[model samples]
Target: MKRIGVFICWCGSNIAGTVDIDKVAAAAGTMNGVVYVDQNKYTCSEIGQAMIKDAIKEYKLDRVVIAACSPRMHENTFRKTVESAGLNPYYLEIANIREQCSWVHKDKEAGTAKAISLIRTAVAKAAMNEALFAVEMPITRRALVIGGGIAGIQAALDIADTGFEVDLVEREPSLGGRMAQLDKTFPTLDCSACILTPKMVDVAQHEKIRLFTYAEVEKVEGYLGNFTVTIRHRARSVDLQKCTGCGECLAKCPAKVASEFEEGLVQRRAIYTPFPQAVPNKPAIDRAHCRFFTTGKCKVCQKVCPADAIDYEMEDRLLTNGYGAIVVATGFDTHKLNDYGEYAYGKHPDVLTSLEFERLLNASGPTGGKILRPSDGKAPKTVAFIQCVGSRDKAKGNSYCAKICCMYTAKHAILLSEKVPGSKAFVFYIDVRTAGKDYEEFYTRAYEECGASYIKGNVSKVFPEGEKLLVRGVDVLSGALVELLVDMVVLAVSVDARADAKELAKKLAVTVNEHKFFTEAHPKLRPVDTQTAGIFLAGVCQGPKDIPETVAQASAAAVKVAAIFSKQSLLSNPTVAEVEQKLCSGDMSCMAVCPYGAISEQVVEERRGREMVTRKIARVNVALCQGCGACTVACRPGAINLKGFTNQQILAEVDAICL
Candidate 1:
């Protein structure tokens, strides 16, 4: 029989003010294997800890129960004290009396009775405890970064700079990603390529970074500290070592396709680079649009290239790599604003998205930085910027603020005024969300200093008339109806989930919120982490964020990876389940009821190498198991038993406490 000691805490008016702590301790003292019972003013206090440890030595107790606060508060502290007194740490149990009993109940007798029941339960639980230890496993010190956008690039660079190798996988042909498509970063007005292309070149040239453009993540398996990732390297149809990027093949190629890098604003040849300053300085042949793929007659790019880099026969290959950690910086896609009929998104030529405006104002864009209306190629005198088109609307099922719209929209208004001098720019927002440092001041400067008109209202409708958009809205604060005949309408749409974020989360067995963003372990403490260990989340894929927030999270994820690598190997919790195959009747009763999928089938073989048939046997993956003991109760054959909290230990403690 296991010797049990029960200690109840009054918690200093927390429990005793409501329940009778003395009677509770008396009831616990009468319980069957319990050799001692006492009430402490505060069980979690230093004096109480000393008394408990001294009593353990005095009574030669094997198990201890504390009826006090929640286990989340002081379970570890008491367990450490027990270990110091030569007792197994797992033999300790905490009964939540203060919150779950005394504080919630109005009747003192009922609360005390409830506290007694809880203490009895803890003694019953602690009597069955067994010693357990953590198992250690080695970890590989490498990382895999999904997506080649700013977030992914920043994470890869941070991890690589910390002396760890990084495999950067980008689905696009170029490394710049969505940042390469932008004209300038908001509020700063700095050239996007000037700041971003340098990082691209650095990634391409870094010894620790293995850049794989035009690649996609096919599979990811294993847990933290040891992950096996399979990446599909799509055939670029051009050899990097041989291609000179001299534009000779691009000039001669006859086939043309829409330039996805420009968001279909311009056209490019079948064999061409994504942009002028593409990293690796190579051109890829678009097999879908190439004439040779359709008719097998034209090899214009191959024949024209002096270096002969084009290879039509190149096929997709799967490459497997091992890494210790993973950063999911999949980024976000813009919400399609065509759903709302209030804005003529696709129907009117003068109404455009913020991305389209970025191209129109870019120096390398189609019009060479000319702010011309798409309808007639004429610069407009008045432009209206609409905010919250697809965000914060219950009809669209997106209720969260996008977090970056205000700052960027203010920047757009200022830049548009600069692009077309003497032009008037009006911004309509549901509310100006400038929550960042110096962000509210920036918004104030846009209105007070730059003379940009800012109004608090939602544009109810937009219609086209003679190459102009008629925007109508009423300012609720000013109590005035306003209508503007603007030459162009730029909708500041909200940032949404990446097109493949849901599919990727499903593949990784990670949870995503209703907004289609990846869910973090905790909103505050573990912001850059996913619930799955070793798999960290960074940037807008987790939520709507600005560039600064994305970079910060990327660095945070790198810190987590570095910490994981600092350990020689990870330790597994020993409080896991164990199965006895001999007692199992092969009826598969425990296998069907177990939620953790710990049970499986095993074949028993004879000594003469004869098959003994397959039987449903239970096995536990100890590292993933939490040792809840539900399987032990469900097993009809009594084959399943938890290691640390065994059935024998629990019943012994229960009998002692109930005596």
Candidate 2:
């Protein structure tokens, strides 16, 4: 015999307007084992919960069913209600009548019938529910942060400040990411390096932080609170301990290649630091272009080094470490302008991407902050800035706004007018999205005070004519064609996911959206959390965002990692799979399908005709099992089963529904 109580919610006419609640409650009372039935206007409210609690006490109910909204919305709320009433939370089951029946049905009679069936199905499942307990696991008080960009730096610094060990890994030779390439930030017009370099220095000086530049995450294993990670440290060819920050080796190297930090706007020696102010300020040999590696002829860098720090035979190293949590802030890359051939990006020397122009504006750049035309070493009197070159265009396959382009474009225009006196600046845009604090005012100042022209349209084509370039487009506002000849053209390209973003996501066992950005656990509530616990997301890797947003998210992710490290132990999910040793055949089929590698084989003793026999059987590790139920289905025999979602309970619910 079982004691059951059924409660139906009107949801303040949200459910009652479509379904007859009174009839459904009456029908529920007739169901076997249902000792009491009641209806409430808002079952999740405090008063409604009181009524259910009183009924459980009055009827001595052991099982309870709540026919309310979707279980995703209120399952945890109702679980707490049952636990406070001195009942096991597992004894409760919810029937989503609002979303599954009432909301989808038009007729009252039909909706009530469907709701009654749903309640019956839930009641059947609750009658067979079993009590389960969570398993306690130990925690590791360490964190791993991927990417050495601003977001990763912020997260690592915050975590290390809380007295926990943190490892910061970057694939590049330098710590400063894209922010280091920029001349100035938007709105405030602060020097980018003035703000970013100090933080980079802080990371180097932090005692609890371990910096691993020129390294990448090779493999990840284990789950929340305990993860084993293997890192691949790429060879730098220069001894970090012996190398000094002198410019002798770089100046003496003969081989040169396009500098990646400068967006290919200038060339750097084969053995050179990414930037002058690079953290550690040490140079690494580019083996691909190095004359020594390529031809075994030039050892100019090795001979020029005063400390003899250069090594031609350095090998890549692999180191494995353990951590409690991980924060991913891999960052983003600018869209390639090959699809926008009309912009003449690769065709004309004067047409430059926004990133290229940013380097041109840098004080340490090739032009020494003069903003000279690349084709000719002369300053441009008239400069044209184009917006949405690879963004907000369906034909180009990218419809999402790059989010920071409009503000950065405005900053470029403002700088062009101030740097070159009497310079004419023309900006062509579809819409100026200045939606940040003081951003609109800043965009307005570019035109009002700076004497820049703001046009409303997309550039159709850019053609080179002598020293100047001709930009042709139609002004959507005036319905007239417009053409402008300018000395330089800067295109605001779209921001996209990094080239290896998807591959990294697979290695981490995290989910990414259609556009390859890492997906969050929840869009609004758990913005920094990933679907995989202990792993978090930060910065533009999650989506397109500005500096302020990236910093905020980075700090939020750090707080989450700190919270995990604060705990001495974590409780594993009780609904994980369990194995019946007597029935397991040890075929190892379950091990093949398990994504978490929770299933394994072990020897067990079984009695056969009064004689003890040692046989192999499958075993389940509850700590590693995520309870996806893939192993249970793969088992040919009924040897494995999920704790709360047992086969008997599911079959009973099916029988009740069919009846």
Candidate 3:
């Protein structure tokens, strides 16, 4: 019989107060195949680990069962302990007594019984365990960064600095994301573009970075250390090689469409660049609005182009490349105000979203930095800023703070007072959340120094009054209803996940929470990492975050990519599914159920009597299999089974537990 050692941890009062540790250890020593049993106050501690290593050497134990906390917490720790003791890591099995038995049960008798059963099951599994080794795969040494926003730019720049090739893909024509459209950032009030534009230029000039503007990541295949990515290069109808960033085409084009860069505050020519300091500075023809595409007659851009760069017949091209890692920094979108019709957003021309107000405050915007009312081109003397429009409201389907709204609203009030002399700025907020560096002081300055009125209340409604808009709300602090006539009303709308976030999450096989924000591997420990290895998350795509946090996350993701590239090869998980060729029925049932596409058909030569015959059987690719064990249950003839969690091993455990 195989020799097994059982280690039971009291876990202080966590397990000992509820379950009898001595009785459980004594019971385990009598179990079949178990040669040694030891109890410890903390088995994961250094002293307990030394005891385990000494016992293994003394008892000549080949398999070990640790009845302790949940495997998620210390499975890897114990696995390493076994490996250090000259034993295979896979030979170790963990019984969750702390969480499953001790913590869950109130009665000591019931807890002791469950703990013994758990330990027995673990010992049974340990007895049937076999040694397995990891498969080494080659690394690609290249990285792909999605989104051209500040996060992606920073990640790309950092990875490129490590002497590895990086492909920076953007859906927009420019490199700057939402930050480019903002007037100024919070607290410090530093110009957004002043800091962001230089990085955009750095990404453009970086020798190791390839800028893929007006592109999207179409498909991603392969596993960690090696991935094949297909990027769809959308037709810009303008050749980057031949075109010089001249204003000839823009000046001559007849088509005028709403500008996305300006948040639809002004009109832009069909043949236009996003902004003056665009990375490439080249213009892309908007095929939807361009007269050449809409009607065969108008080719004003083509005719006016001095370089003859416009290509109306240009087709979208697909470029496939390889990468070692991918960093997703898709960013976020402002919550649409459809549900907040009570604010009269679309109905009233003077009522604006925070984003719209940001564009208005920008010096390059339609009114040339003047905060003018949309209904009438006049500057607003009184501006009302409303906070938490679609945020922290269960009725609107969002119950989380937008995080940046409170600070940005404070920023708006401060800027309003500075830009317009004697302008009255009134802010209505449920709560002022200024919990960042120097943020509270900035909010205090807005009220104390900038002469802005801070009202603790929720805006009830905003309707048209004679010449100005009337904002009605109750001052919660004063316990009085207040109505003020304001020239312009700005709603601090909620920040939400991008519209296509869920679709992209499905494509990448990454998990997104109920808020549609991409879920990280671990919220605190693995903030930059996604559940999928070799893929990382950055910026607001993971959750609502400020620019500082976004940049830090981007750099962290870049460091992860650099670390992967630093390694020549990666070790594949040994717990992946394995196929027994002798038991194969030539059925593809295992292939049908595999979520990661790890199983495939392979031809094998089999001896039938005295002759050899070729037959098809399911083959498992260990690199792709995440050791989920779904293929194990799907096989009818039992040809496929996970290496660490084998059929015999699991059955042995079931038998022991039932007995």
Listed per model in order, the count of residue pairs whose N, CA or C atoms clash below 3 Å is 10, 0, 0
Judging by lDDT, tell me the better candidate of 1 and 3: 3
> Where in model 1 is the C-alpha error above 4 Å?
5-30, 35-74, 77-87, 94-119, 477-480, 576-620, 625-659
Q: Runs in model 3 with CA error above 4 Å?
A: 1-123, 578-621, 628-641, 654-659
* lDDT top scorer: 3
lDDT (Cα) of model 3:
0.91
Q: How do the residues 135-226 of candidate 2 rate in per-residue lDDT, one tens digit apiece?
A: 89988888999999999999999999999999999988889988888999999999999999999999999999999998999999877889
Q: Which ten residues in a row have the lowest lDDT in candidate 3?
A: 591-600
Tell how far residue 421 is off in model 3, in angstroms: 0.4
All candidates: CA RMSD in angstroms? 5.0, 5.7, 5.6
Better of 2 and 3 by TM-score: 3
Lowest-sum lDDT 10-residue window in model 2:
591-600
TM-score of every model versus the real structure = 0.83, 0.81, 0.82
